[model samples]
Target: MHNFLRFFPVFASTLGVVLAVPLNVSHTTISPAPSPTCTEATTTALPPEQDCFYVPPNGWETKEPGAVLRHRFAPQQPFATDTVNYPAWNILYRTTDSNGDPTYAVTTAFAPKDISTPHAMVSFQFNYNSADVNESPSYGIYHDIKPKLWISKYLQHGWFVNLPDFEGPLAAFGAGHMAGYATLDSVRATLKMSQIIGMPRGADQGVRYAMYGYSGGAFATGWAAELQPTYAPDLHFEAAGLGGLFPNGTATLEKLSKLQMSNWAWSSNLRSVMIGLGTMHKKIREVITSSLGKPEWDWNTVIRRLPQEKEVSRLDLKNAVNTAINSPLVRNVLDYDTTLGSHGIPTMPLMFHRADTDQLSAPEDTQELKNVYCNSGASVFLHVHPNTWDDPHFREGLQACLSEDIQTFLATAFARRLYPGCGTDNRPWGDHQYGPIGAR
Candidate 1:
């Protein structure tokens, strides 16, 4: 039932950069490494020259978005050195930023070994919430121990799986427009790369594709789906599987600020969001640092861990908090422009899922997104777990259930059929027998 290309092997190589830094004796300051090495990717047949994986080669920058700047034949050999890697190509491609300025992004493209299953490509956006480009999926999957390990399950199924580093070069983590642009360009580049590589011959043109992500991942997918019609009309994305989508950073920040210290356990995620904001807007860094000055609540620690939302809520520093909130940098950076209905509606089917009760984030985030898209004439199926409400522990279970549902919907979507269509949220959560919840 499966095709085995015994001849194709993935050779492991360093990604050339690291996200974490080593500290000196004081344990207070981080010192950059003495030498930053250029990572050179390689396989059994071809070897990539040493250079920053993202930097474009000569003349590649002049091309349009989706043009392949460079590529490396590297495979994810996580467990051991000799284990066979599912054939994949790490690609750097030209794309645009939120401002429509030329930039570059990266993606990892792969397909079924069998290559004869009426091929479709599923661009799975990786939710890497950091300010470092080295932390992108293509680089982290090969280097970091915790880069969305669940994507491995996709390899077992026979389809093209493309993972895009939606955060552009500056690592503007929360800029939805940039995320969307990079994702669309990743698909564009992959279409061309697929044909040149000849994995599933002719997969380069007119192939129906699906998009998927959760939380930060959904940021990219959500924007891409919204921007597709106006920005990249040629893409045929039949369906998008989105979950835990927080479209506006300002809304999330306001919610966290209002919560009391009793709900501080989820504050670390707030810190992570702040890190993303800081990456995109440098002017807010000092204000943010002062706001998060407490021990154990520092930006760096909370970035690595979770913070207490009550402490971060700033009820005590009323005037100062208000000033920070109203600052130009904060307003400009967290602006919900080009998100959801602000642009154009997605013509494709959308499976939007949200947790009934999440202490770290508001359920209204997804609900609001659904409302806007639906009002704009987009076909959307919203899934809310009736039974899972108020259970903090259900987060993991919720994601797993959503992942399964997305895959199930993709089966129908790729067949050129609309997935259960709009207003179809009767499907049962986790059980799959028509209960409640809809992840596109």
Candidate 2:
């Protein structure tokens, strides 16, 4: 094992004031179980204490991806799912970072009331697309557009739901591979811990699972789906529901770049993509810093100095985005950092939705992705919705998939009643509705 303690301090110092994340380096790892109200350390400021940990047990990676390093119940607050009659388990499981290096991630599991009830597990990845560690799902912090209410419908159906902090420890926003790896591992951990967490006695006849996500979360879902065949052959997701997917890093940037070939002129998510990639690849970081440099608050120095969990305002980032747009070397650097089509094709049944009004990524990107997957004999159903939600295209696309239709789609999949759309490319967008899908 790499001397984690030897590098732990450096990791803490580099991120500036934030404590190091848990690492399960080996199968023999063990640590004193910590209380949910872990004494907040003095250094864990920018991020809330829940997101930071004093070093986890020595084991960083298990021989198996989903091996659980620790399991405990969440405190009597947000995770206190008891009000809804759902008991929650907070888990630390082995996973890999964007670079494919070993690490550990946190996932929260809420089992159904009749623990032994035959239920499918839902690996519901959320769109916590920010640098804030406190924003990680394990922290139980809810953004305004949070999908808990929609997820609640699943809970009401007695389905098991697992919410993973799939971005890895660094909150890598658009880091697809790492997100996918974490999603798979989180499922593994949740499934293995079901008995201890209280599953109904006989439901374990191989609990089937599926993945659901949108926007940034879809980045994880798409990557996770693509990687599952190779990185997690044991995982067999019955269905995957992806929305607002920004699959190709380059295509997404171009669509969002004000200075690039874009129909929408002012989206700066390219900066977020760069920041996320920087967390994994040093070369990418170097290119980002060179183009977006401003000694007083350059991308590198600011990132190196500030706590990653804190919000970086738009005004604070205008200079960097502008610099990247005006500089060819900087813009070209991102050309090499792509996400779509890199991971192998996923064989799971898939439902991909995008808003016709989405300005963040061109519709052609999804079409291209559908073609790629079909060429590999994968079943993919692509849908492009009309702008029903008047919000920004990105937000509209996000809400598009999280609607009642998605919940019904998931529930149907869990019940084993879903059939493939028999589509090789984009399927016609289903009509909008206020009721459960297909409820004529």
lDDT of 1 at 295: 38
Give the winner by lDDT. Answer: 2
Write down the lDDT of every candidate, Cα atoms only. Answer: 0.60, 0.61
Looking at model 2, residue 267 earns an lDDT score of 25
Q: lDDT of candidate 1 vs native?
A: 0.60
Compared with the true structure, what per-residue lDDT tens digits does model 1 show for residues 1-440? 00111232221111111211110011111111112455544432211123355566777658988888888765443333524356677788999877677888778887555543556778888666655555567766765543334455555556677888787766666677889999999999998886654545442544668898766787789899988998899887878887666666666566555542334322333444555655555567767655555433444553433233344443543333445668776676567532455767888888876656644356666667777776776777777654443433235333442246667767667776563435535344545432222333
lDDT of 2 at 230: 95
Residue-level lDDT of model 2, residues 313-341, one tens digit each, is: 34434445555545555444444335677
Give the top-scoring candidate (TM-score).
2
Q: How many clashes (backbone atoms < 3 Å, residues ≥3 apart in a chain or on different chains) does model 1 have?
A: 12
Q: Which segments of model 1 are wrong by more than 4 Å?
A: 1-39, 43-51, 75-84, 143-149, 201-206, 256-268, 282-323, 337-339, 387-403, 419-421, 424-427, 433-440
Error of 1 at 213 (Å): 0.2
